[model samples]
Target: MPPPLTTTTTTFLLLITASLLLTITTSQDSDPDSDCTNKWIHIRQLPPQFNLDLLTNCSEYPLYDNFCPYTSNHGLGQKTHNNSHSWYRTDPFMLELIFHRRILEYPCLTSDPNLAKAIYLPYYSGIDSIKYLFGPEYNFSSQHGLDLFHYLSKTDTPSIWKRNFGHDHFLVMARPAWDFSQPISNDPPLFGTSFLELPQFFNVTALTLESRAYPWQEQAIPYPTSFHPPNLAYLESWINRVRRSRRNTLMLFVGGGGISANPNIRRSIRLECENSTSLSTHETGYGKLCEFVDCSNGICEHDPIKFMKPMLQASFCLQPPGDTPTRRSTFDGFLSGCIPVFFEEMSGKRQYNWHLPEAEYGEFSVFIPKEDVVFKGVRIVDVLMSIPRVEVRRMREKVLEMMPRVMYRKHGSSLGLRSKKDAFDIAIEETLQKIKSRVEEFAAQ
Candidate 1:
């Protein structure tokens, strides 16, 4: 027995509450821990961008995510991309987001009728998948997530894939049959067919990164379950905001993760150096096997974190793509306040994954192809001679200008999402929906 206006207000309030519940319920349909809040996820894969301190010295920083120690479980591209190799094999974890959720490991694939039907998971992340080594019927699609291979060339044929290749949206991972002599194109010897093609194909095509398009934009996806790691370091204030003081400095990149061990993989660096510039004594002697170099100034090692700390003190960092093009060292250099000197391979070889920030390699980073490098024209040494030391320093400053957006990591603004970064949140959410929709469509068959 309320007043008429009061009754109307109550009805309106109730309606709004009901509507909110419905919305949340829909969102929770895919995310069971939607309402639960906690410190952070443990057993999380740390992004390459994370410094070694945050990764290795978990005991030093109590404020960071202590629940999850950076273990081999989070090793990048190890288990998924190189399962056949005994040395590279690692424990499997769900690549997708897990919010205090139990991870189901598909270590061995046995065709059990009761086994939940295989879910098609597309890996758009630059890191290759180890699934190929297992030789399981995989569901693959250029339509789901980011497909770097298909993005390079339109009219890329999906038909060459084997029928049991699990064409729907998944395919088994196997070594590529093609040679590295050929670059990415719509032509035959599709790299996606097997793992062997992985080494031969570098991710350096620069098609999608230059085009500013995500691989999954054309497809429909489901709402991604928030990618919370089971354990992560406690959120620190330092991580909340990127350090702004450091700008354009010398960055000597060192990469030795799972990808560096492959003999077939080697980055061709293009630096702006004088033709007469010497290969830091180390390169001349060790060449590809070069580990660390003690120069007149300091030590140069193949450790990204070590390279970052000192390199950030200088105006430019020498960023060479790792053995394969999908190497993210260049991006990592940019995050450390060091401008990348991009060395594109004239061999038409592409290295590193797509989704790289677009900027003039010369302005912020220096891009030198392998042929030019050999010719000593735009070689790292040549550029160093052409520009004054002061000018080179200024170019490094330009890289610092764009640092905030370049580095990918969990920020203070993160809403419980880990493993999946905030920068990619919207894209990942859409990707999940597309994957779900595609999966449903395939199941209908």
Candidate 2:
């Protein structure tokens, strides 16, 4: 070894080493492409009416009362005071805004459409259609629908369309697919516009909350829940809390009946809950059947804590099909780490293929057919009781693991814990892969 250096020389060498390390770390952090791979996406620069207009007219947005509070934190919604940790009550329909914002802020986003692997059309079709359809003026709905179709048809460049006939492009609708594909009959019911019916959208992939059963083009995504964590620490803490939290109730059915066209199924579920509560004194020790609120009266709790309380404290959360086959509550159940019991396939099985694990049926959730619950005289409580405690724990763990994938963290959030991929990240990856596969298939032909 060399002779020991003087104090001044040693200090200078140590400082030089530290400075070099800092420089390298700073360069990595400041690099725009550090987090992004080669998959670059191009977002169409559409008129402000498509995206920005929705936020600009937030107060006039349909269900403005519910949409306004959840607009902050990059559409992650407002924070709750009930919990010590960071939790939000983000609106499910605000996904359009979140997706648009995330794509614009994406590290892999390219201004040149020529270099993009996939094209994202940032249109607020869900809110736009809802505004016209929900209004008293029916003709406005029809005219608005016509105008949207015309706009898309006229504005699309020949070069873009010729590339793959819009196969590489995608649109994200925050509402169900049915909301945009209204029947165009002789006497069509004016429920929604026929945006999806337009020929220009035929080859395009649609990312919607609910997809049609016949067509495979529409990919089902998770409805935004109220638990957007800022970072991995918050996410892990919440998951740990859920894992350790006492589940006092055996099962919970927290929705109203009489709202749907066929309310018999919902009615049956409510009746079962009532019956189970009344018979809790018997030997089965079925525990308690908790019904948080009556959603039929349109008085359901919007508070995140109130909504999650019953789900968190319950072993199984009843997930009956809502107005659509899927309900936002399904995601809420996943967030609470409560095992969800489904009555239909579309409710969870067919939907959320991108986010959920490719596990066999009943591996992570319970699937009690509606007929079994209604016609065959099977009880929800009896089916749940049949499962072993060990199995229930396993299923809950799987659900807890899925919590991160379903969550949409704050846009431009630091990628702390590289393994923790959020909804936006997953969507972008999937979209790019899909476009690549489709392009390859076309080339092969």
Residue range 125-187, candidate 2, lDDT tens digits: 777776667655444444544554455556655576467767788888888988777655515
TM-scores of the models, in the order given? 0.40, 0.84
- Candidate 2 colliding pairs, count: 1
Instruction: Give the winner by TM-score.
Output: 2
Model 1 per-residue lDDT tens digits across residues 1-445 = 3123333224323543453344334433433233222111111122222212222232233222221222233321122233222112211121221111111111212122112122222222212322221223123311111333343222233332222122122211111112112223324323333322243122111112211112221221111111112223322222222244343222243543322333221222312222123445343221221222123122221123345455445444554433334333455455555555555541112321212333344466566554565454444534544556667557656655544333333212234425433323322333334444554654577
TM-score of 1: 0.40
Model 2 gets an lDDT of 0.70
* TM-score of model 2 (CA atoms): 0.84
In angstroms, the error of model 1 at 24 is 6.0
Which candidate leads in lDDT?
A: 2
